[model samples]
Target: MTNPRQPHQPRQLSLNAFLHDTGHHEASWRHPESSAERAHDIEFYVEQAQKAEAAKLDGVFFADIPGLWAATPYRPTAHLEPITRLSAMAARTEKIGLIATASTTFHEPYNLARLFSSLDIISGGRAGWNIVTTQSEAVARNFSLATMPDPAERYARAQEFIDVVTKLWDSWEDDAVLADRDSGRYFDPDKVHAINHVGRFFQVEGALAAPRSPQGRPVYVQAGSSNEGRAFAARNAEAIFTAHQTLGDAQAFYDDIKSRAARFGRDPGHVKILPGISPFLGDTEQEAKELQQYFNELTVPAYGIGQLESLAGISLGHLELDERVPVELFAGSGDVLDNNRSRLQVVANIVERDRPTLRQLLHRLAGGRGHNVVAGTPLQVADIITEWFENGAADGFNVMPPLYPQLLDAFTAGVVPILQERGLFRTEYAGSTLRDHYGLPRPDSLYAATAAATTA
Candidate 1:
């Protein structure tokens, strides 16, 4: 079968190593492959970043949370702040993009704009902002709110938040910084205009504190699958981080989101939908399955019950381990219970299909709940990625390693070379910035366009 897109000629797949504390699974630190002792150490993260850069991967991403999860013996609860760590990482690595998550729900637009702009400047343009509206109730208390806002309200505020932030980034014209010591003028006041943004959620009447970022703005990345989330991403996200358990699910999401992009007058091709993939690799298929089993066996059932409580919104302690979850438990939920619909759906599907005991379900989700988890040899793993990318089920992937550095090392060393040999991945980065790395066009400064038009 001849494919029209085949002329695209195995477009080099984008890969980002999603660096979690030790690994993506909550119980990974308990595994022998992970180093729990160094989870808090900055050097550990820096080394991971360096490894990704050395492998010539596109970027390294750090997911963040503003509040702690319910105390669990199985999971490490502590984490270093992502932006500060990435700032330190910027100094050590030269090429790989540094992406960090920041929630719009808890932060002011002006401040976030300055933070990411500064990161872009420091990293010489390789910066990405993974925009998220936090789904944690615990986070609300930290921000002096009684409870988390509704998802619809959060998305509304997020839209305005992004609009205001982009305006602030655009406030300082590209040529605003003169740096002409001879004239004793550091900037052109006329060029540095105030955003004067007034919106339903916030009001800021000034320009951003920093100069223009190297890429004009940090690459706008988003990771949400709700309808509101999809709309927001279609309008603003350059890259999307998504999670799905099956090939059918991933393809459905891929088609839906890309179809929505066109309604916003965006080139569907411009919004890269990268599903999260957690691969467990070994010399042979049996060894890989054994490795996966090892991690699942290491999982603590109590912790899994706690996590399942969050997803199902029903305490599982009363239910027998071997009993099937009742469908009635999910009926007519309010926002608190339904905040994570995607995750809830995954749980429902698992319960319906596998009919697994409580103990078994916990093990199934140990490696990253509902995201595609594959246990195979390097060739087998590569085949999955190739099939997904070639079949339009994914543009690429946000690689979630089941264990840190070792799992990452295996993918970069084993799977990456196969991809390169097959011309499905790049041997060297095509450009420097995150935008360039993703083949996205740099947006022209709104200020620049107005000025040139006025002069003519």
Candidate 2:
């Protein structure tokens, strides 16, 4: 019989570690325990993956941008390529899911398809692709465009980008390969096909070179919560990484995404929405707050001001740290607080609701770049997660530590056990593949489905 206490089924929460350099806190590198010097060390990342696996967390995510983010000079910006690093991680860890971000704007569909297919195979189906349309204007210029690609145009291209890539991944049927020595035959010619895809933004001849990867294709994960982004995710994403400051905000976004997915003829349960949470855990609430404050105090004011300006697309040089920002300042910024979509809106809500001083606002965003930042004891952190998970606010969370392995260690050791004892999270991994971890089904190959229909 199954262990009576063992975690079971569809009710469990899915957690992923958002592995940023050093930590999520802007001044984490300056922390005494931070491993800042090893920012570029491959083992630094490998260890993180291993640790998450040890805790039986669902996955580890690496978000990327083609060019330097506007605030590069403020923190440790140097890093290894995500796919390359993840491939290395795949070799070291056994069951942890490996998720890496790749831009639809920066790569050709075929090349991107092959890279993820290889990753899925390398990790025995423990791979996920975090699809993104590059948003920063500075990064766009690096690709030779004088300005950022329009969001609509970028997403349109992204739509086609996934279409073509999925076709390539579906090119070879799972059983297409048969190395029959006596029969002197290789893969069944009938089972492999060329896509012959042509679209508004991309045109490509079909037939991916590789056989269908372990999970058919990397599990489609996305992070945008914009009106456009939600539509895209409703049609494609299996998991979504998002930001939220309150339960109401999270619930509204959750309901919208689920409703949209149902409209697209999808099972709403298949689309897992995970908001980002950066926790500062300690023995007591006061200690947790102090820990958060220590990191905040180390941050540079100039960098925070510059970062705020860049992200919100506004000028803040004129505002004093202690003064309340004028509500009208964000009036023209599209849907800042009215809709919970953009980063600016997150800032707007903080300003409108908390009415925080400029310095307070900077410190708030400095922690997770608009993601929720919580400081509490382990039980408090677990309680927050439980409330959100049970109250229709989230399916899971992207766990971002304010500092590196130290914060990760605290979560796995301190918080996870509470979640486990409460039957909210798994104490051990149930399956090997990422899809198994999240309880998402493996998709049938498009070609296979077509052929099965014809036969019927």
Best by TM-score: 2
* Model 1 C-alpha lDDT per residue in residues 401-449, reported as the tens digit of each score: 9999799999999999999999888888767788777777777777777
**lDDT score, candidate 1:** 0.85
For model 1, what is the error of residue 305's alpha carbon versus the real structure, in angstroms, after optimal superposition?
A: 0.9
Model 2 misplacement above 4 A:
1-10, 334-341
For model 1, where is the 10-residue window of minimal lDDT? 1-10
RMSD of each: 3.6, 2.8
For model 2, how does the per-residue alpha-carbon lDDT over 1-456 read when each residue is reduced to its tens digit? 011222444498999999998999999999988899999999999999999999999999998887665545678876678999999999999999999999998899999998999999999998899999977777777788888677788889999999999899999998999998989888899999999998898888978878888888788999887778889999999999999999999999999999999999998988999999999999999999999999999998899988877766679889888888877776755553211238778777888888888899989998999999999999999999999999999999999999999999999999999999999999888788999888887787888999999999
| TM-scores for every predicted model | 0.94, 0.96
